[model samples]
Target: MGSDNSTLSSDVITLNHGVQQYFIPSCEKNRKIKIIATPNPSKGLVNINFENWDDIELSLSVFDALGKLILNTKLNTRNTQLNLSDLSSGIYIISIDNHCGGASSFKLILNSN
Candidate 1:
């Protein structure tokens, strides 16, 4: 709801019954980053691409639609590929948790065909 930077990057959501949710973008307000996966509806070969944050390790978490933790690892590089051929077809969430109290999430679809 409030942003400490010049741009409006932070978001606050209020739901019924006074429920509040806060969303923060990547680490620093000025630093731009992206997480890309090739062959989106892939049958296992997944390549995640992002800008390398020198010296800063990124924590990655992959969860299924049922909120089950699928993969957890630390990425020290900017580009990486994952072989998820063993996973079943479904919707999954990939979260990048930064050390600067910043977080980014994305949805991934895995199709084994």
Candidate 2:
């Protein structure tokens, strides 16, 4: 991703009524941003989150080992949840479509129980 994960400050949050929603910007490559990868060895559930300006839309897609499309989701809300309990044991790629042809990806190693 071109966008630096640094642009995503940990302090920017959105609250409605009494709920607090944290917004993070997508790491765009051309933008020179790096996104952090997590859960190194994730289990049944995995979460892909980003932070940035208040008004940015990002799309996230998941692909499997066979280079097959698995899950495709959009995040205009702030945060989204991805369920990996049903996926097979292997490494998967979560692609975050940021901007200007730049996309950020995270590698997930899942061990099925």
Local lDDT at 49 for model 1: 69
Clashing residue pairs, backbone N/CA/C < 3 A, model 1: 1-12
Model 1 residue 43 lDDT score: 78
Q: What TM-score does prediction 2 earn?
A: 0.62
Give the per-residue lDDT digits (tens) of candidate 2, residues 6-43: 33234433333322233334344333333343454667
Model 1 lDDT tens row, 3-101: 443323333322222222223355667665555556566778778767435446788898989999989999888788888889999888878777887
- lDDT per prediction? 0.68, 0.59
Identify the candidate with maximal TM-score.
1
Query: In lDDT terms, how accurate is model 2?
Result: 0.59
Clashes (candidate 2):
19
Error of 2 at 26 (Å): 6.1
